[model samples]
Target chain A: MDIRTLCLGILALGDATGYEIKKMVAEGSFSFFSEASYGSIYPALTKLTTEGLIECRQESQSNRPDKKIYSLTEAGRAALEDSLAKDPRPDKNRSEFLASLLFAEAVAPERINSLVQDRITSHKRQIDALKLMRAEEDSPVGQFVLDYGIQVQQAAYDFLIANKGRIVTKL
Target chain B: MDIRTLCLGILALGDATGYEIKKMVAEGSFSFFSEASYGSIYPALTKLTTEGLIECRQESQSNRPDKKIYSLTEAGRAALEDSLAKDPRPDKNRSEFLASLLFAEAVAPERINSLVQDRITSHKRQIDALKLMRAEEDSPVGQFVLDYGIQVQQAAYDFLIANKGRIVTKL
Candidate 1:
């Protein structure tokens, strides 16, 4: 989905500043399946505000710039609901690791070992983070998505460990 | 990796027309982890040829227009090797399915069931296709990557089937 639709969905939960929206996407539950940077989020928020799907109010700060708190309008809620009703595009697993592995013959065995080892470590870290998130998530849907992430990452981690020797030794 | 690098990698396998390169990405072994469209591939091919990374020759077809076959140059092989030596970016799992499920409360229970069911079917199909590819693959690295794809897809498929009720019933 587009960042605008995602922003509307985030606001549907509660009012948030653009910074809060970016944080929610980058470091929160949505981090696993979606992405939005400040560059894209601010533009999306602005457009959503202009289109009347969302409204922004400036909260004054004593020592800092005013915080623009954004909340969903009735139209925004409708739009989010409408988006959920439509069929989502299929998942895309864009793994540069896997693509690089496709050319494994070109690299040294040491390079292959290091790459797989790094991936194993990365997956472990992600699984741990998801577990932490799982403890804090009370919603069934939230827990379900977390479990999905953990399961898939675990499978990949296990596969890499089990199969690393196959590629490394062959090189 | 960029499409230009990918194109070079494909030609590393053998000389192929742009159509063949597109097919290899869309339907061949690379389908699961990479993507390229004609719109992007053609420009990359043009740029690569100009840069002396690849060379293309036009062969007249019997009934259709002349077909351009591209092959990697010495520089292209060197470039592909250079890319392999660098660290790959981490994988990105952009799943609209999971993202939609995150806001499951906004949609109907039936919609949730149908979405999950469709995902299950897609994963099953992917697993079957990957298995077929695995049989045809002779290289250990090729088999390794295919196995990774199948295992992960199986994990996702199983997860959705087992957890569909959790989200649907709550909604």
Candidate 2:
């Protein structure tokens, strides 16, 4: 998704500093489905403010840079709703582990097993995190997103566990 | 993974035109996990050739643009192996559908169902494609990747079919 739309959505939740916006975009509830670096987030926020979809004010802070707080305008809320109503853009998922495994024959057999093992360990952590998040989410939308993450990750972990033997020993 | 390493891996498969390389990268094995656009691929190929990792030979076609076929050199093979042996980068996956669904309350009740139904139908097509691909893949690495795609898509399809109504009705 465009960082502009995402910034509007975040500000709609509540007022936030640019730092908070970047943090939430990277690691919050919607992190799995959306992402933006500070480079992108600051520019997006600036543009949204210029377009009047959002408004920001400055706050003085001790021993730190001044915080710029942002909130969604009424127009921003409508824009977000309109965006959600439209057809979503196609997904673009990146998995370097899968890419490496595709070239498994070139590596030592143990390394293939190692990679799969590492994936399972990391993925399990994600599934557990999602499970906890799902438990706390009362909104159907939040639940739906959490369930999606859980299902996909669980499937990956299951596949690796069930099939690793077949591939690992053969190489 | 970086496009340069990915181009090396694609060339390791066999000699392929830049057009063919992009197709395979976007649609072939590991596609769901790794991606590169023609914008990145051409540069990657050029740089690989310059670095002595890949060699390209021009093929004159009768009525089409002259094709450049890329092949992996011994150094390229070693580089790919070395890459595989290293820890894979963390995955960054985007699901625009899931992102849209996260705002289900903001959208009309019926549109939520519509979005989910579209997602389920499209996801099933991917599951079917992966199944067909898996059946033909004899290599262990190829089979692993296909199975990964199938398992995840299948899990998603199942979840949507079973739980979508509960979420849809409440929205």
Candidate 3:
């Protein structure tokens, strides 16, 4: 999703600063499905505010810049619902590591072996995060989503482990 | 992968017109892993030619605009290999549907159900495409890549099918 729509949806749940929105995406259940950098998030918030879909309150903080807390307006809630009703773009799993593996013959045997191990390790980490998030959530949908991520990541790790020998030998 | 590097890689494989390059990406094994639009391709080709990384020749057609057939130079091959040697960026999957699903309670019942069905159908189609691609190739690496796509996509489809009813009822 575009950062603008994502910010609006997050605000619909509760008010948050721009930093909080980025933090939520990076560390929350949303991390696997969606992500936005500060560069994208800050600009999206400014545009959403100008469009009047969200309202912001500047709160002073000790030893820090004033935090801009943004909340969804009624229009923002409506917008979020409307966007949800539309057909979403297909999910992308654009793994550079997987793509690089296609050219494994070009790399050294040791390099390819290390790359395969790294991918399996990373998948394991994501699976662990998904489990933790699933534990913390009550929403049936959230649980369902986490379950999907866990299964897919685990499947990938298994495939890597099972096939690593041939791939390494060929490399 | 960025469009510029993708274009470079395709040229490294063989000389091809811009239209041919687009067709390759649309229907080739690369479809599963990367994509680029004409908006990015044409400009990239123009820049590459100016930088001496590629050479383009205009071939006039019967009724269409002249086609530019681009070929990679020695410099281009070196550039591509250099890019391959660098640590590639991590893969990123951006899904609007999953993000919206996290807020299923906000959307209409019919919309949620239809969206789930649509997403499931899309992933199934991708899995089918990957299967067809697998049958056309005999290399172990190609087979592995295609199977990887299938494993991940099927997992996604199963998750949606299993959870459809819960999302529909809550919507």
DockQ of 1: 0.70
Clashing pairs in 1: none
DockQ for all models: 0.70, 0.69, 0.55
Candidate 1 local lDDT, A1-171, one digit each (tens) = 888878887787679999998998889988998888999999989999999999999999999989999998988887888888888898888888887777655433446777788889999999999999999998787888899999999998888888888887554
Q: Answer with 2 or 3, whichever has the higher lDDT.
A: 2
Candidate 3 per-residue lDDT, tens place, B1-171, comes to 777778887776568988888877777777777777788788898999999999988889899999889998888877876666666676687778778777655434456667777888898888888889889977676687788778888877887787677666553
Model 3, C-alpha of A10: deviation from truth (Å): 0.7
**A83-167 in candidate 3: lDDT tens per residue?**
8877787766666676566543332334566677788888888889889989998877777778877888888888788877766
- Residue B24, candidate 1: how far off, in angstroms? 1.2
Report the error of model 1 at residue A100, Å.
0.5
User: Could you tell me the lDDT of residue B14 within candidate 1?
Assistant: 80
Question: In terms of DockQ, which candidate is strongest?
Answer: 1
What is model 2's C-alpha RMSD? 2.2
Task: Return the TM-score for each candidate structure.
Answer: 0.94, 0.92, 0.87
What is each candidate's fraction of native interface contacts (fnat)?
A: 0.75, 0.76, 0.59
The C-alpha local distance difference test score for the whole of candidate 2 amounts to 0.80
Question: By the TM-score metric, which is better: model 1 or model 2?
Answer: 1
* Candidate 2: segments with Cα more than 4 A from true spot: A58-63, A107-110, B107-110
